[model samples]
Structure formats: C-alpha cells, structure tokens
Target: MERVRITDDGFTTLFSTEFNQYYHSVRGALDETQRVYIELGLLAKMQETNEINILEIGFGTGLNALVTALEAQKNNLTVQYTTLEPFPISEEDVSSLNYQTGAETDLLQKLHHVKWHENIEISPNFSLQKVNCTLQEFKTSQLFDVVYYDAFAPSSQPELWTVETFTHVASFLKKGGFLTTYCSKTVVRRAMEQAGFKVEKHIGIWGKREVVRAIKL
Candidate 1:
C-alpha cells in the first residue's frame, strides 16, 4: 500500500501507481474543495432543499468532507454525505495534516480523526459515511442532490474522470442535481455532456481560470 505524505501547504500528497501527480497539493487543495465543492456546489443546492445528500469522489484527507460538514452547521442546513476513496490514508497520516489554526482548529481535529467507513455524526446538522472502496464498485440506493467530483486531474487519473465513470454517477443523481469538478479539459467537458448532463463552465479559484460543472436533467 502507498502512503500519503503531507505537503507544505498543509494538504496530503499521495502517489498512486494509478494517477502519478502527487494526488493533491495543499496550497490549492482547500481552495478547490471549499470553493468548487462546498461553497459553490453543495451550499448552493441547500438553498432549496431541506436535506442535502452529497457524494464526493476521492475523499483525500477528508478536507472536502470536513468543509461540507462545517458548512452545514454554520448555515443551519442538514447534510448527509457519502465519500468514496479507494486508497484512504491511515489514521496517523490524517493526524499529520497541518490544518489552519484558530477557528478552524477544532473542526480540523475532528475532520482529521473521524472514524472511517461508518456513518459518524459530527454535528447536529451533519453526518458522514465513508467507503474505502473503488468508485467503480461503490453503490447506493439513494439519489443525491449534489456530487463533488474531486478526483485527480484527467491527466493523472483518466479512468476516474472518464465518460464511463461519470455516466455511472449521472444515473445516481435525481433530476436537477449537479456535479462540480475542477477539470476544464475539453474531453472531460465532452464526457460530461455525453453522460446526459447539461455542462457549463464556471470561473475557478487558485489561479484556475475555468472549471466544468454539470447538471443532470
């Protein structure tokens, strides 16, 4: 099994024989998760729905999950989250994540060490379950309101970002559900479009000029 090492920007970096490019970079990691997944995608969906169910791909270091949970509490929204990670970091590796200090400290700790593979209730408004399995094999009976497609870049993990995988995810979304990703590749955009999604380009953070977001109709 490969190990996840911490990056200077306080994020985890995993090297998979599968995807190659350091998995994640801390400097841009939180920005991407918070901006694209939590703020823009998940929180936006909560405005109209009382209960929001979110599915996140590549649950690296639990950053996205943690952000979503905290956002739910702060915004007075109820969220049930499920994440799929094929190669999860060990608990000790998670503890090593250098999360930001001050107001983010307590939640950072909880997010770092929350038990894996079980539906753990982190707060009144938030609960999460993680599956340490490949995305290809993970299945759920329930449809979701939001999907955070936080996989590696298409240049790294082509299969995860491919049309086949997204098509599978598309089937799991309820009408009008949205999937947000940091990829802006034309091939990926085309893939999302072919998967029965209405694709749109959105401005991205962290020097990322553009990102692709898809809605299932």
Candidate 2:
C-alpha cells in the first residue's frame, strides 16, 4: 500500500509500504526536485540549447514531469520528456497529494492518466512519453539531453543502482548530456563515472549534504 506524506516544506510525497521508502526525501518533495532536477538538470541543459530531450528513471507521482512542464512553459523552451516506471502509483494515491492548485492539478491528472509508450504534448512547450518498463528493459532510439535519475534508493532496490544499469542509462544520453540525482554515495558516483560520465557533487537542498551531477562529455 502507498500513503501520502507531508514533507517539511508542506508539500506532499508518497510513502510505499512495499519498498518501505518515500518517493522523495521527507525534508520536502517540491523543494528538492526543483533544486536537483529543474535547476541543476534541466535549466543547466537549457543554457546550451532551447530544444531538449529528457529521460527520467522514475515517474512515481509524476512530480518531476509536472514541474518540468511548468518550467518549459515559463521559459518558453521546448522539451521532450520520456520517463520509465515499471509500476505506476494508484490514482487514489495520486489524488491524495496536493502539489499545486487550479490548472496545474488538472495538468498533473493528465500526466498520470496519459497512455504509456506514446508521445503526447502536455503543453505548447512540453511533450512527454511515459514508458511502462524498467530502465534495464527500456529500449529507445531517442537520445536525451538530460536524465533525472530518480529511482528508489540503492538500499531498497540495489539492482537499479548497479554499474551495469548506469551504463545502459548512459547510453540513452546524447554527448554532453547531464544526469542528476539526489544521491551522493561514493559507490553511486563511481558507477556513474565507470558508465562514462564526468561526475561532480553539489550541495543539495535537503536529504543529504550533496548530490551527484554527471556530464556525458
């Protein structure tokens, strides 16, 4: 079963009993995502090109995609977002968490309800494809400019965090692409490095002292 959890900043996150994990850090879901994925991952990529392709490892509650769509509209940048989720959360669990109000709630609903494996325009500037498969199982011709490595923690799902998996995930990125994650573990950084990324660590907003940001140059 999954339940809604309120973080320190008052935004909501999902806690999974099956994995005994929270979808995001308990410190704050919105704040952490904005700082890690949006600022470090997407906006950093936007500095180089207006049109970008993004690949995400986990869809979870679709919060990352939701905020990225909003950013795309806000900055008037074009974004192609592809996300992989082996198991989607239930609709009841999705409705329980309130990330935004008014039209954005509807936007979130659309993100959740959209059909898997089909590219659909979510807004004028943002298009999305939700793939119902694991990162290991996902095969695509698309190359992404940035990757949001939001899989469950290594402790919970060690398989997803392995060196072999990172290599496959790295293959999905175009040259000079970025892969950002909320984890700063040495083993994680080493895996990314071995997978052909130039790794760096930056101070994070919550959950840990620093996070990993890898470039595919």
- RMSD vs true structure, all candidates: 3.0, 1.5
Candidate 1 per-residue C-alpha lDDT over 94-193 given as tens digits, one digit per residue, 9 for 90 to 100: 6666654465677756755666778888889988887878889988888989999888787777788778988999888988998998777888988888
Model 2: lDDT of residue 215: 93
TM-score of 1: 0.86
Model 1 residue 27 lDDT score: 51
List runs of model 2 lying over 4 Å from the truth.
206-208
lDDT of 2 by residue, 1-217 (tens): 4377788889899988878899988898999899899999999989999999999999998889999999999899999999999989998988887876575658888899899989999888999999999888899888899999998899999898878998998887998999999988999888888889899999899545798789986
Predictions in order: lDDT: 0.78, 0.89
Candidate 1: regions farther than 4 A off: 1-18, 25-27, 104-109, 112-116, 206-208
- Pairs in clash, predicted candidate 1: none
Query: Which 10 successive residues of model 1 have the least lDDT summed?
Result: 1-10
lDDT assessment of candidate 1: 0.78
